[model samples]
Target: MKLIKKNTERGEEKKKRPKKLKRIKNANPSVVLDRHGNIIRRVDGTEHGDEKRGGQFLAALFEKLIPPGTKAGNKKQKTEMRKKPKRKAESEYNEAVPYDFPGDIIRSIKNTAGDFAGIIGGKSPSAGKAGEEKRGGIRDAAPIRKLSAIRRKFMSLSKAMRRIVIALSALFVALVSVCALNIWASGFRETWKAREASDAEKAALESILDEAFADERSEKLRPLPYRTTPAKLDVRAGAAVLVDTANGCVLYEKNADRLIPPASLTKLFVMYIVFKEVEAGKITMDDIVPLPELSWAVNLPRDASLMHLGQGQTVTLRELMAGLAVASGNDAARAVAYYISGTQEDFVARMNAECRALGLKKTYFVEPSGYDENNITTARELAEFARIYVTHFPQSIEEFHSLKSLDYPLQKNLPSWQKNYGDTLAIHHSNTNPLLGKLDGVDGLKTGFIYESGYNLALTASRNGQRFLSITLQGQGKGTKQGNEGRIHDGTELMEWAFSTFADYEPGKDTSLVFPVPSLASKGNDGKFVNLVPAWKNKITVPHLFGSTAKDSADAVKVVVDVPPYLYGGVKLGAQYGSVKYKLGEITLETVPLVADRSLESAGIAGRFFGTLAKGSLEKNR
Candidate 1:
């Protein structure tokens, strides 16, 4: 019975094996069978008989040759291959795999493997229908074969060479990323800075407007002073203006609004700021100010006017002012600016602020020293500035500006050798202004010169108890010989003409009529008018230099009175009720405040009721 069972089992096993072989043959028709009727396998574990398997093996070889992500394969299969579990002890596992094949043997194995795959994958179309129907042919296999060759050659390189290639590739990628990031970051930074600057400017403008109009009230517009037909003065200045310091009246102007380079005359504003600081007690004349590094670096050049300040030297604010006003020392100016604001740039900002406050429309300062030609202003605006300066800080002119010469540095702080070798090193400097002692009552204010501005002067003088301020900008000629003389001559001529032509006239002694408004609620004088009197006995100057008589002066003067259209009761005595402007032709020579001569009680309740009724009736009738 056991023998019969064994024979049956062997028969069943033999039948099952033949069925499996039949299925394999059906699937790969190109599979070759040996003489023993068994399948043959290559060294790479692929059936030598099946062309499709050979093609798949060739694709696997080529996968190693191509750059990453360039392989042709099913995405799912590739991803699964990448995610294959890593060995727990990878180092030990690699060490256990003895890959000690000789270079030539290894190369031979790779070549055979590639050739086998290529022959099956790259079959000619006429050779077999099955190969022709396959997706890849010799066209595809050709590139793969080449890639394999290249990969083999790369693997044969020295270890150091492979490492160098990998490092260079990484460096290239890093550089690209950094450059892209830098470009984006730089653009963003610039845009942000511009936005911030615009916002700052907008805020500054708003603040300035708020401060300027804080105290303003809505009122009826006053008529602008009419321009009078006046005698034109012969003047040689490129631009000239003359103003009465008492009332801020423009007596004469020629090309007064023309823009011109201010040159060192810009120091006038610097000194003005200095005086303001003194008044505010931020600094004092007796305080010691250190000579800053920037002052030495910028003003030590021979071309720049300087006070010959030495490195690390300390100076009094008073001495610096003397250098600035009398010697026109640019170094002294810079030092003072730095001492006050910690930087010349901040001082320049303060200057522009003052300009805005003073309503100077056409003035700008680029530097405190005015060494740069970019500093600019109009004659009319500068004359106005001088008026303010003299009115507020008259002592500045008296103490610092009238001097003919000043000894700068007080004592030579430089070594004897440097002092002697330096070219035209001046411990003493003569004032650039030529009219210091030449013209009567010509006290101050500033003089400026450069090739661009030629020569300029801000002059103030008092004659017959009336102070006049004048500005002469851009005088003609070249060098000290012609240019200096031309400016001085022009300024002298303007001052002489101004004082000779105009004489101050008091209206009290003149035949001018003072208009009186009728009192609305006065008890004794019910309909009587009260005579208006000047708040102060102020005088207006009239031009008499043209051989004009007193009658002509009287005829030239026209009065414009500004009185409220309606006066309510409860007006107090000496209260300003209106203003009377005295004009010579159309130009206003002076405006005097008109005051009440007597008080008027509020029309008692009944009086106010009747007054309102009368006003309503008058309007109804009109």
Candidate 2:
């Protein structure tokens, strides 16, 4: 090879020759042009046009041909298209993304990327030549297979949901059953609690009735028997009443408000109203009532009793009440009514109004004295009235009923005997009240007999702490005095039976029992250990119908614990304890709480050792 020389920057001679062209085997190329329609640059430099760069070079040529005014901006541009080499197997395996991506995603990525590229280049796809068509268009793979796989996964998830629903339902049912059992057991546990009892207290109250009913001279409840006159004691039908002084219960009753005759019992209600009036301060015992024109008479009728009220005579309200209750004076009734009401009819209206206000549902008064064709009251109604009157106004009996007579002088020396007119014989009247002196605890109420209603009696009495009222209506008796024998007999018998046959009972120490708690149903940390307690210590005293005989006596108290249902594992503590059982004459049982159980915590080894050492040290020091 010959040495070459070339001119150098140092002005030294250098040998040189034309430079050989550097051929690029696969080089991408383009053609450029200037204003003269001349190819200023031939980038590929090949006789046969290079497939890759030929289309790009021709596009650039046309861009430069446009005159400056032909386009929006005067500019000449150049373009080059480079072919992307195919990825070989080795390169494909080296990439993190495998060749086989799911078909759907690959197609979407290419389509989106191509659209973005075209917008930036400012050219439509059709502007690229046939050989460069692939560079401009995006390629995508089919996506049908990927869609099928997604559908398969959805079906699998739906199948699992049904099994989960069934499992949850079963769990819910089991939870409810456990709660129900816990509630049931808690109800019964309350009855097992214990109560303290004393023996001496029980015996003290046992004979309370017998001592209360005992007769004493100062007690003043002895009954007085009166002789009855068949001729004068005439009642087509009638009623009567007697009341106990102690608790104000009824002791005897007759047809107390039947319109038969104002034989005598009507005086009781009249006296009651008068006593009430005085107590209310409307009138005083000393207040005087003027005698009416028809008040007094001598030899008026064979059947009539004498009151001897002069037409112009004035008597105190107290004396009139005494004459009415003790003497059963007809004139006294007229006198008191006229003074209180200004007229007899008005006074009777007051009586009727009084009866209605007292809840005496069956009573009606047309007259103050309960005389014939006027006033009517049932035996039961009178007994109730007597009960209320005597109970609320206890002082009236002593003031009115105990009087032997109502004797007051009309003039300074003219003394007249008012005499006992409660019950009458053929020639004289006497008290007709059946329970007057015959029953213990009995006090003042009145008695009557008439043609219309028959014999009746109302009686009330008290024994121990209990009070009873008995009413007998239309007994086997007529108005005749002997006919009233039935009334007296029934009244006495009934009062005796009420006081003697029945007794009140309280729970004894031995008999006090409690309700039982169901073991499974009670609620607590441990259901078996906890119990419900009774809300109250109940006491019941039922009537003992049997007598005091060996057979009649009640058996020893029996306590039974009733469990309604079997307990379950999750039963609640303090559920219903069962009720205690007892007989009428026997004592009742009380319940109490069970004592608390204690639990101890275990100590660690180090703590236990120290505790033992401390104890030993303390003992040595002591």
TM-score of each: 0.52, 0.41
- Model 2: how far residue 146 lies from native, Å: 67
lDDT, residue 313, candidate 1: 58
Worst 10 residues of 1 by lDDT: 215-224
lDDT of 2 at 611: 36
Q: Which whole-number lDDT from 0 to 100 does residue 421 have in model 2?
A: 30
How many Å off is the CA of 327 in candidate 1? 1.0
Off by over 4 Å in 2: 1-263, 297-302, 312-314, 402-429, 439-441, 461-467, 475-479, 503-542, 545-622
Clashes of 2: 82
| TM-score of model number 1 | 0.52
Look at candidate 1 and give me any clashing residue pairs: 226-586, 227-586, 228-585, 228-586, 228-587
lDDT of 2 by residue, 230-317 (tens): 2222323234444343423233334555533333556667777787787788998887776776566442343544455554455677
* lDDT top scorer: 1
